[model samples]
Target: MVTDKEGYAQLIQYLTEHLGLFENAGSGVDGSTVMELFEDLLAAQIIVVCGQNPELSFSQRNTIIREVDAIMYDLEEILAGCGRQQVNREQSYFITEFTGLVKNLFDHEIAQLVR
Candidate 1:
């Protein structure tokens, strides 16, 4: 991934801090709910900010997917350690699916940043 570990950490931390992991006390991180929103927003931001780069390649786009995967994996581990029952739900599916979608979109948008 083009982004470094520090960048990934910051992004996950921001998600955890702002969106939070729990809907109520002792409920644990609602992985499905929180991650869906996080992934969507993150993908949208990447498309907006870095989409202007015309030289981006397929491999470069894949790198973004891999990087996001790494970050989310790290977060999932942390949440698991916190005693949260990890769920394979919509958010997880979205993460996997969205990563590929972003890469495909990048192929088109690489020539120019489009909304």
Candidate 2:
């Protein structure tokens, strides 16, 4: 049985290897940016899972949310330096591709804990 951490690692590896698929031409989004966005989005989704899991204490959920907020702040800083139009395009592409990847590769299990 794969632990949650291992499952998350596998998903991250898969996403990293397929980072190009999320890239938008002329969007000014580099591979590193795409990966960061991917990670941030994944972390955001995990907060939802954390909320639903009775196993996690309120403090644990708050901690995870706080960490995710920090990540979002960093991501916001990166986007702030980018062109608004380009960032919007890249963000749209990332959301579409990321959602598709989760549906296809992980059968819509964003956390991949079920696998």
Candidate 3:
């Protein structure tokens, strides 16, 4: 299991690295790259969750994974739409909203784990 501080640091680093994806919206954003990013985010979430709750049952872990996967699917659709269009005001807003959602996840759900 990772130490709380270490896990927190890793989450922060992950956010830092991926923030650029939003910053450079519509810049050759491909489906594969988007999928890769979502996969990485899911991995980070799972690691942090499992590290914090080592005693979680297998079923519980599976449930958590399924929930996160559903959320990711919705976000992925929004991102894919953004990628398919020119970077206009509406798309920019969606990108901003998506960034906020990710940040909020770290700030609330993930931070609660590490804390």
Worst 10 residues of 1 by lDDT: 19-28
Indicate the residue-level lDDT of 60 in model 3: 59
Worst 10 residues of 2 by lDDT: 102-111
Q: How much is the lDDT of residue 85 in candidate 1?
A: 39
Model 3 TM-score is 0.45
Model 3: CA > 4 A from native: 1-32, 83-115
Is 1 or 3 the stronger prediction by lDDT? 3
lDDT (Cα, 0-100) at 13 in candidate 2: 65
Better of 1 and 2 by lDDT: 1
Tens digits of per-residue lDDT, candidate 3, 1-115, equal 1223354455446544554445454644333344455555556656765676776668756756665666566555545633333353433444444444444454454444445
lDDT digits (tens) for residues 38-61 of candidate 2? 465556556556555656656755
Q: Tell me, what's the RMSD of every candidate? A: 8.3, 7.6, 9.7
